[model samples]
Target: MFGIGIPELIVILVIALLIFGPNKLPEIAKSIGKAFADFKKAADDVKSSIEHEITKIEEEGKKTEVDATAPAKGAVEDKEIKK
Candidate 1:
């Protein structure tokens, strides 16, 4: 799938069959599949974790912005009351 066409895939598979023989080929393919699955799972987990952290940071930034403005608003109200 990584840019290898059908002919290229066939050649690679033939070479693998010749080198590893039929008996071990399935086992090797199974292990490779599991490795790729594990890698994808890890990548997904990292992506989700980063997204969660970014969302948390954004929420905190919003909260801080609101908090920063609140005191100024209160001061303006106090000045209005004094006047």
Candidate 2:
């Protein structure tokens, strides 16, 4: 997948077979697959946590903005009533 074509893959697999032997190859592949899966899961969890924090911060900001303007609006209404 990383730019290695079929021939390259075959050569690499042959080398692995020579070095690691067929008995250990499947176990290694399984371990590698599990590691990648765990990594992906951790990344997704962090992404979701960050998104939740951002959403909470945005909501708090909107609430603060509305609260800040409310007092001014009330002051304006009071002046209009006096006039």
Candidate 1 residue lDDT tens string, 35-79: 999999999999999999999999999999999877664356656
TM-scores, all models, native as reference: 0.86, 0.81
lDDT of 2 at 46: 100
Off by over 4 Å in 2: 72-83
Residue 20 of model 2 has an lDDT of 96
Stretches off by above 4 angstroms in model 1 are 72-83
Candidate 2 local lDDT, residue 6: 100
Compared with the true structure, model 2 gives a TM-score of: 0.81
| Model 2 CA lDDT for position 72 | 66
